[model samples]
Target chain A: MSEVPNLDIIIKGCSKNDRESQKQLYKLYYSYAMSICLRYSRNYDDAVEVLNDAFMKVFSNIDKYDTARPFKAWLRVILINASIDHYKKNLKHNKNQELSETQGMTSDFRPDNEIRYEDLMRLVQKLSPVYRAVFNLYVIDGYKHKEIAEMLNINVSTSKANLTKAKANLRKMLKVYEDAAI
Target chain B: MQPYKDDIDQLFQEGLSSGNIPFDESAWIKMEKRLDAADTIAFAYWKLIYPLAVILVIVLAIWLWPGTSDNAESAPPVVTENIETHNNTDANPSSANNESSTTPEIGAKEKESYKQAPEEEDNAETDTTTLTESLGPSKISAENTDEPDVVRATVSENEATENSPSFTGGGEEYQSRFGGDLKILEGLDWMALDGYRGGEVEMTEVPMDTTREEVIKKSKLLFGLTVSNDWSAVGVSEFTNSGPSIGAIVEYLVLKRISVLAGASIGSRKYSAVGEEYWRPRWMDRSPGNEINTIAANCRVVDIPVNIYYHFAPKGLNQFSIGSGISSYLMLREDYAYTYNFADPNLPDTWVWENRNKHYFGVYNLSVVYRRQLSDKLYLGVEPYFKIPLTEIGIGEVDLYSFGTTVSLKFKK
Candidate 1:
């Protein structure tokens, strides 16, 4: 039952719809959960929306939590699912550039490894909702493309295409940022 | 420090991994309101679940309780009575049942019955008196007297545990003097309906054995539909690919503690490869150039799985089992889309290999399955499994090892 520190009482309270305890629980993992939401969100406002939605789920389903597992893993899954839900509303624009067209674009695209974390997050935020979602799911969250496709209600090739384009766009943005840095 | 320019997955994985978001009090306030609203709605709706659950529990209890089979059972057999029975006139034994009177053997049996009648008369009278007491005056007259109204008291008219006993014991004849109306098994201990009079006895007990066997056999065989997601990792490739599989599964319990399971499903084995590790089939016109490319190989396959499971707990509401199996993957259709570096495309730009075979041998699999019996004939199950590939498959011809979980709803025969 290794939970986040001081979570036993707060989780119980949250399950009981205790306001103060819910607040404490939310604040406890606010930044941690928001970091994930941000990578998948378009901006700060969107990130907050996803974070709040994920928290709502956590509080609503608090009683179902198994204390034997790590709490973060459970919370992470909920956050990812919530992010996917938010992304689905934006999935109508599900178009991607042809894979062949993605060629010749990476020439001399030496990555600026010294790029700051905040800048990288901004660069990720610049991707379209579907691309950012696919990138976040496949790269950071380590979901397979098949899982991403199911979550996003799309095909496997679409997930792969989105991930490839996401990385390409990120590199292109990194290049512009690197030239600006010089 | 230099890095592989194309492989940026790790870069973002590391960059975005720093956890924690600044606490937003406004967001919490907004969520609190939503939670309060949700709580009210949930309370209003969830109250009905209690009553529903209670009703379901009552139904389940009655359904599963032992010996309370059906009203058709538990209900007493109907016997028609009140026909005036004729007086015992002709003691023609051959006209009564399946015996011939002219035969010396039957004559000897009748003489034996006449002898035993005097000795067993006291017990016979007492048992008959009980049947006579259940209704109007008895129709049977062992002393050959008046025609009594037919008594509706029927013995062995309902199903009993099947018992086949000797027709005669101690040389005492079971044949009644009047013959068929009161044919009795003199040595059968299952029932001693010593004084059933003027009632036609039907052999209803024999059918119960087949009925019981049918129920047992039906429960032993289970049929189910299954859906699963498996991730296959080709040899020496860091990438793990996933595909959805839908199938039908059949399980037959061969023993109390073991069962055999088999399934046939169509599944996709697709992956995103981003390195030089490429296995080309004979279909491609060109070979690999000196550049990293992306090959999104999409494959549809038929997987046949055969396995044996040993149950840890078989007869219960919940069952746990460990199983090991072999799966054969047959590639049906495969299409690979290759996007290579733009620079090096002059020298053939493609590669090919021969020895293309559609049939892939079995991949060994092991799984732990948990099933909860939802009803007498239905079960819900989840099985987590791992498959180690002994055969190379797909257009890439890679040893595609996979691990996944399958969810199933099974119905027992």
Candidate 2:
């Protein structure tokens, strides 16, 4: 990881169209952007794709950047657009149906032990792209359901429904582990 | 009880830290390589093509168009006003009789002042007393049609010379013929001049001038009407996704090329989905009977945009403009968001509302506009501008930006 500069310095460098500056900027915000991507993505791959696209736009338009703003805030907007673009392109082909059915879903549980973070992550990864995205955005990334709905072109109700469902599913997964321990 | 929800957050945070995220090494490498090998040469080459072609075409056409400087110097101007009047009166035999028999006699001074054009001289002495009586009402228009290009009517005591009655003014014969105004009409050159001083100046009927420039300018103003279109992206700050937009414009000119623009494009910032699919409950499947459960309740204004703009453009055809100005915007809908939860699939699909702490503020814009001048006072223009936020429109550290195009019309002052 590179040492991140103050937002002023990054914006000044971006205005100069400096490549290293752009790369540095990307590194600083890549995690946040990627987190957002994962939420909207079907898998890690799709999230990464959205992240890359968002970075590309940031680079091309860096000269148009203003220095008075927080860098992460600006980066978030780009990531969101890129994610929306990615979603629009890949939405039809997504196999969301498989992840929608809650019936007969099996959960892995740890007996007589505290649950591992890694194991939780594995379960998150196992979630359908749509569910994972909503869960991450609402719970982890702190995005509002309305925003998610607009970005995803769905109704506000859908976003709310998904958040509730995502949380419930996660709770269920965690319940299995508790039951196993018992 | 297992602390499922509490542990899940930590688990996800851990997952985020690990090397779980995928990277496209080759794609990034190729993209970087392409960026490194910039195509400056291709761009440079294309730049020269337009100017050269324009210069060549202009030069060749000027060479072929007939030069008329010498002929213009010697050619007699076609008489306009005075000649037209003389010809009108001469063509009517009834007018000739009226001139001879009018009851009202001309004043001696007036009779001596009127002079007939050379063409009308034969009937000059035919008791012009009657013509003098008819002069008051017809004089206003008569100046436009009178025949003689220039007639010097000097009242001379030369007796009613051809044995015909002549209106005498102060013991002199009066002549009534004169031609066009040389000095006034001389300035009506090939350029776009102001309204009529010599001929008709009515807006309802523009005079017939068939030159290319005149036709183009007139048509531009005649069809002049304004039109404007703009769109704004919501929930985006540094990088905004322009959302659905609304705007209004008006075009008013002879050529219909000039326009006045006032519109607001919703440009908060751009955004992306976490992926092709956002998060959702595993139980809500939207098939035959489960349709209600498939309903999606959206999040709140985590990021929303409100944009306002005012633009001006001159003349141009499609995708072109000839003038430039500013595109001002005000960002209203910040990144605040609300959420709605849905009922379980086993139950019916119902919505539950929730709100989040999202905020937005600040303003940003692009000032470049593409202007095309289609006429003297008309234009069509487009601005494919981008807005980069100076600060987060919201309280978060998320960056915001947006890209979009706007069309405008410019009018002559």
Candidate 3:
């Protein structure tokens, strides 16, 4: 892991377009940005792309950054927007439809059982782009369905439906993992 | 399902959030390359825009300076006293005839004094009077019968002389037989007239009646077409979304100096963004490297503006005006497309997103307009305008403010 520098100095350097400060800033936030991007993206490669793009934006608009705000939060917002932009660009080919009827899942699963992080990531990646985006935005990011609807340019009901379907798909994937572990 | 669903969600959320994913070292190299490329393109765009803006400013300054001079030359002085007298005489012709018959005797006395003056010996005034008297009683009767023409001609002739004193004393002259005032004496120094003509001096009559009627008749409606470059005022240097705007408008002159304008315009705004999309090939067990896409969001807007203008000189050929209005924007189409690097070589890459249900926004504008009359019915105008958003354009919190210069061609009816 790269040692994080003082944010104020890094921001100032980035604002001046200094490559070393930008590289340092990118390294410090790399893991956090990757984690968020991965949840919103289809695969590890897509997550890396989102991370790079987000970092570029951070470096480019560093002058607008306020020192009072958390840099991580600001970086996360850019990543989310980048992810959505990616989705929008590829929306024409996206064949995933909103499942109208909610699917019921088995209730016998244990919550305390440990699951590998890689396994969880795989399950999350299996969900459709719309479902994954809605799921991550609502469940992990704590955004309301209305806010998600506005951000993604979709109806609130569609946002709710996608979240429900994402959870259902995850439950089924988790069942297989649980069975294999046993 | 509900009881276990919460636990499953918590497990996934905690698991995903806790992981310390390693950054790919190779991705930074690609990202740095893209950042460098973007910087070059941005610099090139600025290099083009800066000179264009400076040239436009200089051109506008040159055009506006001469416009004031043209307007000053076109606005004729208003003949207030003559217009009132003419209207009264037209209403009562019998009274006009009585005044005309008696005024000529006084005019004859004035003519004698005018001729006796040593300076008046070489004057053209004596010849004009001789020509009128030799035309006989028929012409005299005709002049007495129609008084307005005689008065108008006398006024026009007096106005032609630059150095002549006001018609208070030496200025009065009898109506010539030619139905016009006598010409000035020849010995008068023409140099005095030329010297006093400099600056904003009133040189001609306004012809109030004709001007009022012409303004009421010809200036009721106007149509115009405009083209401009628009950019955000608040982060002006940082904003790269400045775009071109085109519009057509119709104005109704509610009063001579004030008009109400309504028009529709189509314009676009663009911004650069970076994005990534995932692709997995059937041959590979793991996902391939993320494909970097440089995207530009192009937003097309349809705007309708309603404004009221106050003209500095509505009757003049060249006029300066200030106006304030409200413009409503309806988002017609918005698309995010990859501007660089097509991923698929074989399949025709149609990568774009069309957004719907876009909310309408409003902007308030203040503008200064300079119009130069090209002909009796056509005018060319340059308006520099400032616009402020009354409402947010989209979900974004940034308030969009813009300053632009518009060049227009207007037709008045």
Best by DockQ: 1
lDDT for each residue of candidate 2 in A1-182, tens digit (9 for 90 to 100) = 11245656776676676777766666666556666676566556666667777777676666544443344655665676676677667667665446643332244444435445445555665566567767776666556676677556678898888777777787776565555556
Off by over 4 Å in 3: A1-5, A96-113, B1-6, B44-54, B57-304, B308-326, B330-413
Can you tell me the CAPRI class of model 2? incorrect
Model 3: per-residue Cα lDDT over B182-291, one tens digit each: 43221001111111111112223322355445543454677777777776533334356678877788988676468888998777765544433212112111114434
* lDDT (tens digit, per residue) of candidate 1 on A30-93: 8888888889887898888888898887887788665544577678767877888788755654
**Structure candidate 1, residue pairs in collision:** A31-B20, A31-B21, A32-B20, A32-B21, B218-B413, B286-B350, B286-B351, B287-B350, B287-B351
Per residue, candidate 2 scores C-alpha lDDT tens digits across B1-413 of: 43544655656655554543434455456546655665343246745544554454344334322233332332222222221222334443333321111122222222232343333455643323212211110111221113223221111122224444432221122234112211112212111122112222112222223442343343322121222222333334322234423233333232223333333333223343221122343223322233221222222222222333332221112233232223433434333221223322122122222222233344455445565543333444566755565554332223344556654444332
- What are the root-mean-square deviations of the candidates from the true structure over C-alphas? 17.0, 17.1, 15.8
Report the C-alpha displacement of residue B100, candidate 2, in angstroms.
22
Best by TM-score: 3
lDDT (C-alpha) at residue B318 in model 1:
60
The candidate, 1 or 3, that scores higher on TM-score is 3
Q: What TM-score, computed on C-alpha atoms, does each candidate reach?
A: 0.40, 0.43, 0.53
